[model samples]
Target: MVENRRRSEEPLHCLVTGASGYIGGRLVPELLAAGHRVRCMARSPGKLRDHPWAGDVDTVRGDVQDAESVAAALRGIDVAYYLVHSGSGAGFEAADRRAAEIFAAQADACGVQRIVYLGGLTPRGIPESSISPHLRSRAEVGHVFLDGPVPATVLRAAVVIGSGSASFEMLRYLTERLPVMVTPSWVHTRTQPIGVRDVLRYLVGSATMTDEVDRAFDIGGPEVLTYREMMCRYAAVAGLPRRLIVPVPVLTPRLSSHWVGLVTPVPAALARPLTESLRYEVVCSEHDIATYVPDLPGRPLPFDEALSLALRRVREAQVATRWSSASAPGAPSDPLPTDPDWAGGSLYQDERLSPVDASGEALWRVVEGIGGENGWYSFPLAWAVRGWLDRFVGGVGLRRGRRDTERLRVGDSLDFWRVEEIEPGRLLRLRAEMRLPGLAWLEMWVETDPQGGTRYRQRALFHPRGLLGHVYWWLVLPFHALVFGGMTRNITLAAVKGAPARVNEARAVRIRGDRRTRRTSQR
Candidate 1:
């Protein structure tokens, strides 16, 4: 009888599309915590392999636009999550509609019981014809799922505030960078914003609701505030000083997008959609979700509380997912080039060498533990500025750090870089993941000198795309001097000082960076 009861207590199996996306990445862990089995579908399954919960669920390699892959993913899935959106490039609306049609058809064919989709909250008191393309596409996708044969629940939310979220980052940078600003009239447009944590809760909870929930439900945080008010509240929570605002209607969404593109990490494509949507107010029109799923144990977090949570995650360096995790549309998914001349392209390099009176193993320890809590072995302030700039333009930034301090494996993330090669005590290669105009890499290695000492080589290599890449490198060359030169000196010094107490030979010696000794490495 016990065996029979155990067999009857099987968990529900769910398939999550867009597993590489921001909310989808976080949603997998939440679903697992809720005792449901999850299957993540990604165009490149390798992208999900590094996630903390990677081992907890199954992954299927597929795209929603491909009917076969969709059917395969939907096989035996009780609930399917449609979290994908093509709101970036040209004709994204048509692309979104086609993807939704294919997904709904496949889910129905696979006999999935219910489909749960997350979309944007529609603007209130506005005609459908005048609705922003971003919101309109989202609503249409939700409609496709609801109209399918399977029962479906559509959860529409406003801006989601969380660490690494594109929407939240825009607000964060704008408020932090500018104490006084000329703003568009849309800054005063009232809208409801929701915490990512609360949104996740609603998403996970909706899976358990019965088929009686077949329509759309609007979800949001407890407060309905203007974008201006939200930014001010964020500043208050973050302990930032009061900001001055001047409203101006002359700055249209296009102009605002360009300005935001320059200031924030979000590019013009994403910024345009966001700015367009902000022209109208987006508040929860119905309380159906509250009645259907109910609040988790306490009142939902207000704007300030949510903003605090996001900041805490950033401070702790515990971000589970970033908005940039999704692979670029045509980027190569394979590991970055490790061979110096693997690709035929124009190359420029900066190389530095430091002689250390330590063993190769000793030097390797310092190199392996270069990032994370140890910090970069150079101009930390400059590194922080670059990281901030990267984050503003939708790059990974330096917040990711290293997965392991004492050790590294190929494919591990080191700050805004991905490890491409690790040769034990000999070498380490990192491919830049931060937004750049060209391909770049930082390589380091330790070798035994013929004179019974350790020699460390550090090189920064770039393959320019066009004039932009060349200008970018030259523009930052001076900063690189302070960063790279100091980095080489400090790394060798750390190796010498960090040598075991018994190694008196290493402990007695010192090293310093000499830019005059610099030479370009083979590329």
Candidate 2:
């Protein structure tokens, strides 16, 4: 019976509603890896970055609010992952509540088999059950979905422990920045934290195993530790000794949310939901989920183990952006070096300027000619090879050509470089498409003053990921200089040659026209 059920739902064609979110962003890739064809539904289809397999999956731009769009997005989608929440939207609770109902109904109408959601996990059966508005809303959203549409397989989980996640980022920044911590009553609350990997496994694994479960279930990591303990464990994995953790009863969730905004990268809007949920004890009530998701059956992730792995992945992603050619094509061939001396990823930026006598117009032409037919103005072969490798990292290889022969505009994608900023004869700055350990930018400018016809300059900017990220900058200084200098010189020479020819042609045309007019007058 299990085999038949598994085969019937084999390679589930899944549709994720919040494919652009952090969880959904990771979930799309996970679902695909599990032999499922995924339709990534998000508010902005363009927001979907260039993943190597980006073309394989379907992408639909639709909001949960618009019934028509939602119905269309859910059409033919088997397992629709309800990853959306009211946090960032206009109608926080009402909008989310309504949207889920509409989507659940739409999913039912569309024949979707399951609606997988990751929401807040609060102990519901307790005698004096008191939960915050945020937790209550989350629970309501799940219940509304499960009751209406397809069998809703709700995976109620605590704050996911990973980088780039709001909850995780709040925790990460609080511990990293504050060597001496202050007090929050919620710090003493016992909670079960789960690793992102386990959460993903349970969500994907739930699709195949649906025999006994008809409703929502709690999903958490292996340990039930206090908020303070979770913080200390995170510190240990970060290789830092735990600082003093003091729990104060006076600090309210409102006050704590603001404090988080000041201390963590998490903004106030994001912090409030997490901070509100922190008031209640977020632990699993039953262990009956053993037979379903075997990966997490025996044990949940140790706080330290989850922290180490999640941090490593974030570091890797940051660094991956650096070395990956998609970060910047035709960029100086010099990549940030691996200082085994550092951990995770290397992120660093090097900036230098060399004089190249090129006209603004000529330089503009060269910049326009970048990518596609002309190849990158600097390190053409290296750029091509790098782009080819980026294809391995799941990026768009040098396929998209320029829109026009000589014009540029914003929002236009040029090969790997999205048109970030453009000035006709002066500046062209491109954000890196290739992966990097951190954020990076490449810029070329032709500055023309009254005294100077044009001055060509190039800059490479990198934002480091961590300690190693800083080290990456110092190591690649010389090579960046070399590659950047060569590119600048080439652009200068190309522009210089191009300008005079046009000038001479104009002069010659004027002389010929003058002679013709003089002869006509004599006649």
lDDT of candidates 1 onward, in order:
0.77, 0.69
lDDT value for model 1? 0.77
> For residues 1-523, could you state the per-residue lDDT of candidate 2 as single tens digits?
2222543345888888776666776676677778999888878787665544468789988988888999998888767888888774455778778888888888888887677788878765653236766777788888887787467678888877754466666776676556688968888888888877778878778777663456778888878888888778777776665668777789888899998877755668778878988888878986555567775344566778778766663333233333333342111111111201122222344555555565566667776666565556677776777679878888876777667544678767777777777767767777767654445667777776568766776777675543344455567566665567677777677777784346446757988999999999999
**Cα deviation in Å at residue 206, candidate 1?**
0.9
Stretches > 4 Å off in candidate 1: 1-10, 314-360, 364-487, 490-523
Off by over 4 Å in 2: 1-4, 88-91, 125-130, 296-299, 313-523
Worst 10 residues of 1 by lDDT: 331-340
Error of 2 at 114 (Å): 1.8
Top TM-score hit: 1
TM-score of each: 0.68, 0.64
